[model samples]
Target: MSTLEPVEITAGSLHLRPWRPGDADAVFAVCQDPEIQRWTTIPSPYHRDDATGFVDGRSPANWATGTAAQFAVVDATSGELLASVGLQDLRDPAGHPGVAPGGDGEVGYWCAATARGRGVVTSAVEVLCRWGFGPLELARIRWIALTGNEASRRVAVKAGFAIDPAPRSLPHPRDGVIANFWTGVLLP
Candidate 1:
């Protein structure tokens, strides 16, 4: 695994950094939004414990092992959690699956309810894609959304992703059912 540190990234009005323990409350609140639950893999009934586990455990562990590089998008001036974005399923050149492996990374993100419609996520995603191409040396970054997730599709398009015409099946994290999904790709 790569021992490289998760560096903070800054954009015009926002900054991205690893999640901290103090972020649990914000995480919990945002994850409770109906829109977030409907579109992403976050626990449908998100609870404090889930948020705690994510900020205190999962986020740190991912960083330490280089399995994923998750970030908390915050307001540069106020330091509020505007959203979450990550480059997941990072692999190496040999195409071995997992942390620090060589290959493409999947981009995932969710914007807080209050922060939607302002292009917060789209801007953050653009910053992350540039980081993936530069510091992370990623060849390509992929995006996927359930077929009806038009908001997410728009963000991908705004961030320069080329949406694929074909739809594929993506398994729901909480249920065994698979749903039709759309995919997009951005090459470095």
Candidate 2:
């Protein structure tokens, strides 16, 4: 059995925890915000149904499959859903792909509009990264941001993700052509 850990983390005003059905309403409300739709890949006309489906369907399935891990980032003090963070493409935790099997993982995150400019996401990201590198024993964590997302880039930089010298192409929602991407790696 792949030992899965139950994770709950906190930093400053941010708290990270697993998703629940009740989060559907909160996610729907946040997704409905124009800023989220504009800056992220979420559907432009995000509806309650979409959020409900994500909470009740995709999130749980990911947990069961052990392919991904996602956490809802909330305000520790207010218990407001402020963002989401996760790790993907995990190989292992110790730098070896086969023996002890440590490899690269991807870091992804997004913050609610109201949570922007408040340092909430940044603090939360730091906490999450520490957990990924420490308890998860991940060898490397990669961060990628869309070329024009300066806000996201700032968050990445703040969370120890340095910009690469050259950008690469990454998938984009509105644009058919691959968009410019910034990549950073945290190595153990």
Candidate 3:
């Protein structure tokens, strides 16, 4: 597995970067959005500790282990937390043994309530995919949205992904069986 260093990506007015310790409150607040809670896999009844844990442990470990690469999207001018975007399950699917962020990966994201409907997530995801398809050498980046998640679906479409509208999402660790979700694909 190839562990990658974290990076900052600029997509128009959005700044994507590694999660920081001071972002706990913003994380806590954004995770509380109903859309974030319902459509995404973030924990229900989101708590401050969950944000702290994510900022302190989960995010860094994912990058360090090459298991995932998550970015905190913020407004470049205001420095406000705007969304979350990431590539996860980065496996080297070439019959090569250990895990590596190549061959195939999944893109996932959620926008803060205020950032919704502004095309920020779409821009962020596009930039992330470009980076993944380049430096990460990933051949494909996929997007999965729970059924009825039109906002996410629209973002995927805007980001140039083709959706199959099938319940093809694999089981998730936190949400368990994902029997009713749409899947989209972006090939590089």
Candidate 4:
């Protein structure tokens, strides 16, 4: 139902592209990182089937439905998967109202363990934010991380997000326990 088409974006040495079927193996491998499992909503065990479903089903479905614009951030020269970023629709897919205005989206990302500490994710985020602001015409892009995710917080700040001072309650990744979360925002 998307009025938009998925497109490729570039930022220096990185290219953000749509997920391909062949990317299942890389997706599975990246999701195996302990940091990813701990900090993200990805399934704890992160089975191969889960990656397959995401690459073959969820990614395409999101694009087709205009629910999210997700990308596999790759090294332009080597074509290596460095990370994943998404601009997720904040509006309820089931037709309920969203927490923000209609044009708001949420930014989420995870870095491959091998690709961490190198600024790959930060650069990719900057590019994604630009795309969201331009072609997607998003009014705002929000970022959230569980409290204590300093690495993610640093990335958001480095990419120009204004961090909120107050922490909010959010569902834990594994259990539904309420956990403190930090939020940030970037506006067009």
Question: Quick one: best lDDT, which candidate?
Answer: 1
For 46-89, candidate 4 gives per-residue lDDT tens digits of 99999999999988887877778789999999999999998876
- Candidate 2 Cα errors over 4 Å, as ranges: 1-3, 93-101, 173-176
CA lDDT, every model vs. true structure: 0.89, 0.75, 0.86, 0.86
In angstroms, the error of model 2 at 74 is: 1.2
Candidate 3 backbone collisions, by pair: none
lDDT of 1 by residue, 89-184 (tens): 787777665544236889999999989999999999999999988877788898999999999999999999999999998787678698899999
* TM-scores, each model vs. reference: 0.95, 0.86, 0.93, 0.91
Q: Cα deviation of 75 in candidate 1 (Å)?
A: 0.4
Superior candidate under lDDT, 1 versus 4? 1
What's the lDDT for candidate 1? 0.89
Query: Ten consecutive residues with minimal summed lDDT in candidate 2?
Result: 92-101
Q: Write the per-residue lDDT of candidate 2 for residues 3-88, one digit (tens) a residue.
A: 34547887666789978899998998878777668677676798888888878887766656544567899878888898988775
Model 1 bad stretches (over 4 Å): 98-102
Candidate 4 scores a C-alpha RMSD against the true structure in Å of: 2.7
What's the CA RMSD for each of the models?
Answer: 1.4, 3.1, 1.9, 2.7
lDDT of 2: 0.75
Give each model's clash number: 7, 3, 0, 0
lDDT of 3 at 83: 95
